[model samples]
Each structure stands twice: as C-alpha cells, then as structure tokens.
Target: RKLPGAAGAADEGAADAIRELEEQLEQATQSLRAREEESKAAEKRGQALNSKLRRAQAALAQARAEARRHAEAGAHQDQELRDQVASLSSELDRARRKLKRAGKRHEEDKADKAARKELQEDFERRGTELYKMNDKLREAVERADLLGKALAMQADEVEQLRKHVGEADEWRAKCDRLSMAEAAAAVG
Candidate 1:
C-alpha cells in the first residue's frame, strides 16, 4: 500500500508540472504573437520613413537644380547688363562728340552772321555816298547848261556891233571926197 500511494503522489506532481508547462507555453506564444505584430508595425514605419526620405531627397535635388539654373540665368543677365552698359557708354561718348561739333558749328555761324552784318553796313554807307555824288553831278550839269546858253547870246551881240562899225567907215570916206571937189572948182 505505501508503494501505490507513493506512485499516485508522483503522478499528481507530474500532471501539475505538465499543466504549468502548457500554461507557460501558451503565454509564450501570445507574447511571440504580440512581438511579431510589433515587428510588422516597425517594418511599415521604416518603409514609410524610407519613402519620405526618398521624396525629400528628390525635392532637395530639384531645388538644387533650380538654384543652379537661376544662378546661370543671373550670370547671363549680368553679362547682358555689362554689354548694355558698354553700348550706352559708347553712345554717350558719340553724343558728347556730336554736341561739341554742334557747338563749334554754332560759333562759326555766329561769326558768319557778324561778317554779313558788317558787309551790309558797309554797303549801305557806300550806297548813301553814291547817292550824294550823283546829286552833285546833276547840279554841275545844270550849271554848265546855263553857262553855255549865256555864251551863245554874247557871241551874237558881238557880230552885230562889227557890222555897224563897217557902215560908219564908208560914210566918212564919201564926205571927204565931196569937200575936195568943191575946193577945186572955186580955185578954177
């Protein structure tokens, strides 16, 4: 009877151990399932993070490319601006030269105008002198005409006086002859 009682107690202890082991195994399996779920969540989060990182990197590369393009455009604009400035400077120099030439031409025109004015004044003075000389010449011509008329009248009067003297001489001769003849008769 002691041997059977001892075997029965050992069998009860073995069954209790087996029940405890089964409970531990069930708890471990539940814990492993929870861990596997957590691992899957972590993998999804990592993939999301990698996708976000790739997108961020792509955006950064695009931004860098845009910045390089903008920089190149700015350089091109700067070069164009420099060319424009050079062109403007050249235009300004040409304009300044043209202005200087125009100023010189204006001075020459002023001088020419002054010379023309002086010539005009001289011509006017000469014209006035010529008018006065013409008037003097007309007066001299009128005086000469009057003197010629008076000289012609004096020549006609001298001719008439000479004829009267000739007639007087003939009459004197005749008177002397008559006197001489009367004296001869008385003597005879």
Candidate 2:
C-alpha cells in the first residue's frame, strides 16, 4: 500500500504547476509589451493627424490672406472680382462645416467640464463623510478601551472581596471549633 513514488508525486505536481504558471506569466508579459507598442503607435498616429489638421488650417488662412492681397492690388479688375466671388463661395461652404464641428466640440467640452466639476464635488462630499466616520470610530474605540480598563479594575476588586470572604469564613470556623471545645470541657 505504500508506494515510494507517491511522496514525490505531490512535489512533481507542484513543480508542473509552477512551470505552467511561469509560462502563463511569460505570455502575459509579452502581450502587455505588444499592447504598449500598439498604444505608442496609436499616439504617433494621433499626433500626425493633429499636425496635418494644423497644416490644413494654416493653408486656409494663407488662402484668405492671398485673397485680401489680390483684392487690394486690383480694385478695378472685373475678372479678379469674378474669381474672388467663386473662391469665396467655396470658402463659405467649408467655413460653415468647420463652424458646425467647432460648435459641437465646444458643447462636448462644456459637458465634460460640468461632469468633472460634479465628480470633484462628490469626491469632496464622500471624503468629508469618511473623515467624520473615522472620527466617530476613533471615539468609539477610545470609549471601549476606557470601559475595558474600568471592567478590569472592578474584576480586581471583586477578587479581593472573595479573598476577604474566604478569610472571614476561616475565622468563623475556628471560633465555632473553640466554642464547642469550651462547652465540652465545661460539661466534663
């Protein structure tokens, strides 16, 4: 009934489990590293997109500046005015779309600010409540400690009273024995 290998079986099982855990940990580490690289790539892409957006905005501003220069250079040219009119029409459409997007972004920003403000207020309120609860808990613990000390003192007093009662009983027993002996002697 006693297999010698049975003792090593438990150790072998534990070793296998440790090996499997090590493999799992290695896989998790690799996965996390991959995700971190992906996150960095995404950040780069976002920065590139923002850079392109800024370049496009600068180009639009340059176009407007150029149009102003052209108008100033030729007040009497009918052809320039016609070209300017067509360009202005196209610019107006793009400007309208940009304005709409800006308005939406502004509203979203406003809502985000409100949410953040509410969250901060809630955190402060909860923190105040937590502090108050902590104070009450401390006071309760102090009261318990004081009561424990009082109880210990009372217990000591009770023990002393018990000792005194034992002594009194011993003295009474001795007196009774002496009285019985004296009465017997008198009778004799």
Candidate 3:
C-alpha cells in the first residue's frame, strides 16, 4: 500500500508541472499575434505616405516646366518688340531728314509769300483808314444838324422880341393919356 501511494503522488506532481507549462505557452502565443497585427498596420501607413510624396514631386516638376515655357515666350515677345522699336527709330530718322530738306525749300517760298502778306496788310490798313474817315463824316453831319436846330431856335427868339417891342409902344400911349387927365384936374 505504501509503494502504491508514493508512486501515485509522484504522478500527480508531474501532471501539475505539465499543466503550468502549457498555460505559459498559450500566453506567449497571444502576445506574438498582437505584435504581428501592429507591424502590418505600420507597413500600410508607410506605403500611403510614400505615394503622397511621389505625387507632390510630379506636380512640382509640372509647375517648373510651365514656368520655363512662360519665360521663353516672354523672351521671344520682348525680342520682337525690340526689333520693331529699332526699325521705327530708323524710319523716324529718315523722315526727319526729309522734313529738314522740305523746310529749306519752304524757306525760299516764304519770301514771295511774305511780300504778298505785306501787300494784303497795306490794303487792310487803308480800308481801316477809310472806315475811320466815314465815321468822322457821319459825326460832322450830326454836328451840322445840331447847328441848324440852334439857328432855328434863334430865329424863333427874334420874332418873340419883336412882339414884346410892340406891346411896350401900346403901354406908353395909355400912360400919356392918364398924365393929361391928371394935368386938367389940377388946372380946374
């Protein structure tokens, strides 16, 4: 009975150690699975960020190309404008020289034109003088009319003076009759 009891106890202890070792192994396997999931998520995020960087680089290259094209077009336009300005300047210089020669010929014509202008001015001055003389004649006619009216007034005043002299003679005769009557009364 003793030998059987000892052998049964040894078997029970070995079974408990085996059960503990199995629990530890299951815990380690769960931890390894969680770490694998985290690694996969990190890899996906890295790929997305790399794709965004590539897109940004491509857009930057396109913008640079557009800027270069604009610069080249502007340079060509500026060169064309410069060439046009140069040609216009040369044409202007030629026109100025031709105008100077025409001006020299115009100077020769100016002497004849100046003589004609002087004759026209003399005629204008004579016409102005005639107009002034006509104005003076009109004023003289007005003065003659005024003098004729004054002479007519003087003639009317002379007739009034003659009437006044006749009235004075009549008054003198009446005064003489009154004086004779007064003398007769005194004598009687």
Q: What is the C-alpha lDDT of each candidate?
A: 0.55, 0.55, 0.54
Q: List pairs with backbone clashes in candidate 3.
A: none
Cα lDDT tens digits for candidate 2, 17-109: 666655655565565556556555555555555555555555545555554554443443444545655665565556556756778867555
Candidate 3: tens digits of C-alpha lDDT, residues 73-128? 55565566566556655755565567567787575455445645654675566556
TM-score of each: 0.51, 0.45, 0.45
What is the Cα-based TM-score of model 1? Answer: 0.51
Q: What is the model-wide C-alpha lDDT for candidate 2?
A: 0.55
Error of 1 at 125 (Å): 64
Question: Tens digits of per-residue lDDT for model 1 on 1-188?
Answer: 33377798987776676666556555655655565565555555555555555555555555556555555655565566566556655755565567567888675555556655665675566556556655554555555455455445544554554444444444434434544543443343
User: Candidate 2: where is the Cα deviation over 4 Å?
Assistant: 1-103
RMSD of each: 80.9, 39.5, 66.7
